[model samples]
Target: MAAGAPMGAGNSSRIYKGSGWKLLFPSWIIIGIFLLAPVLMMGVYSFLTKEFRGGVIWQFSLDAYDQFFFDRGLFGDEPPRLEWTYIGIFWRSIWQAGLATLACLLIGFPTAWFIATRDPKSRSTWLFLVTIPYWVNLLIRTVSMKFLIRDTGPLNEFLLSIGVIDAPLGLINTNFAVQLGLFYSYLPFMVLPIYAAVERYDFSLSEAAADLYAGRWTILRLVILPVVKPGIVAGCILVFVPSLGAFLAPDLLGGAKTFMIGSLIEEQFKGNAGNWPFGAAASMILLTIVMCVLLVYARNQNKVEAR
Candidate 1:
């Protein structure tokens, strides 16, 4: 009976281990269906020939990528010349996203630090206030922003009332308005991560540095920032990546006059262009850029861990 008991325990242990592996199957299936399958489909579509209206022809062609890198003119019979239109669009998107990220970092860092230093009972209230605006639909918030900043909007009226300016600010449909929209939309992403990091930091380090005759700037530069840098990077990535691919802000805020990468890709499929292969190619390129950014971050993180 003693030998039989050991055999039964071993059997049960094996059964438990088998069930654990079985539990992972659902997650694997979800990732395959939702993530990997779409990316693979896009990759294949990007290489395929484009149909006239809205589909792929399935035959292999480099025309989509060729069009992006080189312009063959309206007839496609002319000798190819370097394309600057798409390149300009990409540069504009990068510039907008970078500026938005910088704005968020400047505002968010101070706001996060203030929250972290608050009394424990008040911290939650402050966080709640920060997130409350996001509970409303994003489109609505964006439209409300439009109302506030337009030439005839309350902002201009208020300025006029105070004699701050002779005329309307003319903020609507401008790059500055788009930047404002992007900054408003993603500021929370910056603040929450930074707040979490600052909350975990030890103030004793600052005191110790001060005791050693370190100035306020020196302590902040050398001691505080290093410990909280991961959170700052995370916040920037969160803001910048989404801003790079954002279409709504550019569409509504910029009056659809300027095309960011997101707007350009969206227009290919949904607008009169009806070029599926080109859209897929653009998506693939955007995905590659995002992946490269993530890869660089991961490598830096690995180096930090190694040290």
Candidate 2:
């Protein structure tokens, strides 16, 4: 009976371990097949030569990387002359994304504070309203913006009717339009995180600051900002990363004037210039930049937690 008891205990232990793995097996399969496989394929494609047609050639080459930094044989075959075109596109993407993030912060902070101060029932309602735009397709939303802002659109017609201007302001297909589109699209993302932080915040600190005769600005700077810093960071990251790779807004709103990295990558793949290898290289570069940003964010978070 004692020997049989020991065997039963071992079997139960084995079954427990097996069950644990069984729970994680599907997630592992999904990550391996969907995430890891595509990334691996992209890495391989980045190194291969691009065919003149549309796909990649099997031969490994560094031409794609070179294309980003140099104009081949431009200096009478001395060396590949430095070309800033692709680098400029990356920088433009960063600039636009950063601007969009800043705009989100500017708008989101006040909106979040307003929502956070509302009654619980109203808070949910306001958040629902904020997120309602997301239910509509992004492409559709951007196109709608085009209709509203274009020269012959409703905005111009209304202004013309009101005697605000002699001619319609050329608002569409401009940088301002792009920024507006990004801000409108990502505002909810920025607001929600900050609202969560505000809801969790202790108002006692603000009260204490007020009791000490601190100015409103001082109280906000010293007490409120620190408390909600994490939310701001989270919101910034959420807005910035996606904005960096924004294609639809830049393509539809900014037009030919704004050539961001996302549009540049799209051009390489689907546009008249179908260079798959270069596109893969550009994607990898963008991935590396995003990874670096995440690493920095993680390190900062760890430091804050440590303190």
Candidate 3:
């Protein structure tokens, strides 16, 4: 009877483990099929030669990478010269994304603090209002911004009515317009993470700092920021990464004059100029940058967790 009992228990344990794997099998399959496969294919495509017609030739070549780094048209038939056009585009993307992230942080931190300081019953209501923008499609929101900021838009009408300016400001089709769209779209992402951190914070620390005669700025700089660093880091990552690859907002707001990497990539793939290989290479480069950011974020998180 004792031997039979041991066998039954072992069988039950095996069944439990098997069931756990069974539950996870579908997720693993979906990830491999949908996510991993596409990324791997893109990586493969990046190394291939582009067909003049509109597709990749599948012959391995580094022409796409060469064009990205070098290939000044000034060389003519000679060897490719170093041109910084693509590099400039990359820098512009980074700069725009950084500015948008900074704007979100500046605005979000205060907004988050406001929500966090609210009573528990009203906190949910305030958070809900913050998220109201998400209810509308991003495309719709961006388009609506165009209508509001155009020369003939309500914003100009209001300013003219108030006698603030003699002429209507050209708000659309400018970098400022693009930044505004990005800030408006991603503000919620920045706020939510910071709000989460603030909600979990100990206000007693700030009170103790105040008791020690620390000024408001000093307390905020020393006591509050350190504790909320993780959330800030998280919010920055969320805002910066998407803003870096932002497509719709830039396309709609910045116009043809302001060319971004996202627009460049779109042109290569779906636009009149269909060079899939070059597009794939550009995507890989962007992915590498994002991965670096993620690694840095992960390292910072680990350091915070250790402390």
Q: What lDDT does the true structure give each of the candidates?
A: 0.91, 0.91, 0.90
* lDDT for predicted candidate 3 compared with the true structure: 0.90
Model 2: how far residue 152 lies from native, Å: 0.6
Residues 1-307, candidate 1, lDDT per residue (tens digit)?
A: 3343446554557555555667789999999999999999999999999888788898999888898889999999999999998888888898999999999999999999999999999999999999999999888999999999998999999999999999999899999999999999999999999999999999999999999999999999999999999899999999999999998888888865557998888887885457888888988988998899899999999888666
Q: Highest TM-score, which number?
A: 1
Q: Give each model a TM-score.
A: 0.90, 0.90, 0.90
TM-score of 1: 0.90
True-structure RMSD, every candidate: 6.7, 7.2, 6.6
| Candidate 2 segments whose C-alpha is farther than 4 A from its true place | 1-22, 74-78
Q: Which 10 successive residues of model 2 have the least lDDT summed?
A: 1-10
| Model 3, runs deviating above 4 Å | 1-22, 72-76, 304-307
